[model samples]
Target: MTQATLSADRSDANANANAGAAAGALRRIGAHLAPWLAPLAILLAWEFAARSGVLSTRVLPEPLAVVKAAWSLIQSGEMWADVKVSTWRAVSGFTIGGGIGLVLGLATGLFKPAEIALDSTVQMVRNIPALAMIPLVILWFGIEEQAKVFLVALGVFFPIYVNTFHGVRSVDANLGRARKARRRRRPARHPHHVSGRASAAVEERAAKRDARPRPQCPRRCARRAR
Candidate 1:
């Protein structure tokens, strides 16, 4: 076969193989979503119940009713304003508290002196329930946006801090072995493989060596050729 034709055939094969692989991946993902079918069925049942008044409309609104309410809010622009406020509060709070937690976690994980200085206070604060802190939070920040942001930040901080601390501390123990195992399983290199230019140079040198006339004893030289 011509080199160009052979290359075209190989390219087509590779494209087909990639398309098959993608199809198989999508099928597997669809299969994994089968577990979600039960939850979907339950949601349908809940809507049916709400529509038939088997469930009190006051206690639990119909799904359609909720959707309509949300749609109305959106049409009125109230939803957008509320979303903006909530988003601002959540993002600001998370950024402030998460940053602090990350820094503290890193410091405590790495340095004994920092741990000794800060860990006790953090643990004590973490143990106190958020509800219990509301009165104090109100006293400090008052009933304002600051109070809401502070409360959200406080709620978000401990989990991030604890998880980060543990992850940092256990990283060598957990991830180090996995890293080594992956390295060990890497495919072996081809012993005969060489770059195109190098292989060409090697072939040229061998051709020259073979073509060169070697000086030999006069008796042996003709016999060797024969």
Candidate 2:
């Protein structure tokens, strides 16, 4: 082929590759953005409704108004201070309550006797609404920082306890059976058999399994697929 013709063909091939890449990238971007469409539509409708005088600004402000207020707070430094205080409170309460819940959850999950003894009492406490405790809490703790922290801790406790308990309970029966079968097949684990490489492999497998996305409900899966 002539040099000019060869160069033209090479340029055409490069252009085609670039166009293909750009089209693929756009498709990927659209796929990522598809889920956000519903929320964006809702926001637009809300702003339009507020602007059209159908909704009172006092009762339900415009989305833009809310954004402006947030920006104002950010400029005034109040937002940062509020965030700092709330974060400190949440972390303090969560740490204290979650620590206790973890201990209790493990104890109850592992021991049937502990579950029988403590589970009923914990369930009863959980049944009582946090709002109902306000008067009693005020009477005893007198609306101090301790009372606020206690309320936050109480709010934080139940979810942590429930999840921890379920997580311990969710240990696969098949895994236990498999372990027993292996033990029976080889009555003793030799030092060579229990090598660092084998242990590391098991741990890495576990980490990857844990990192994998969990199965969603049928409806959610369908929605996401769309």
For every candidate in turn, the CA RMSD to the true structure comes to 14.0, 24.5
Q: What's the true lDDT of residue 46 in model 2?
A: 91
Model 1 global lDDT (CA atoms, 0 to 1)? 0.90
Error of 1 at 96 (Å): 0.7
Question: TM-score for all predictions?
Answer: 0.59, 0.64
Q: What are the per-residue Cα lDDT tens digits for candidate 1 across 69-185?
A: 999999999999999999999999999889889999999988889989998999999999889999999999999999999998888889889998887888676577888777865
Worst 10 residues of 1 by lDDT: 185-194
Superposed model 2: Cα runs more than 4 Å off = 1-19, 129-144, 172-226
Global local distance difference test of model 2: 0.91
What is each predicted model's overall lDDT from 0 to 1? Answer: 0.90, 0.91
Error of 2 at 117 (Å): 1.0
The TM-score measured for candidate 1 stands at 0.59
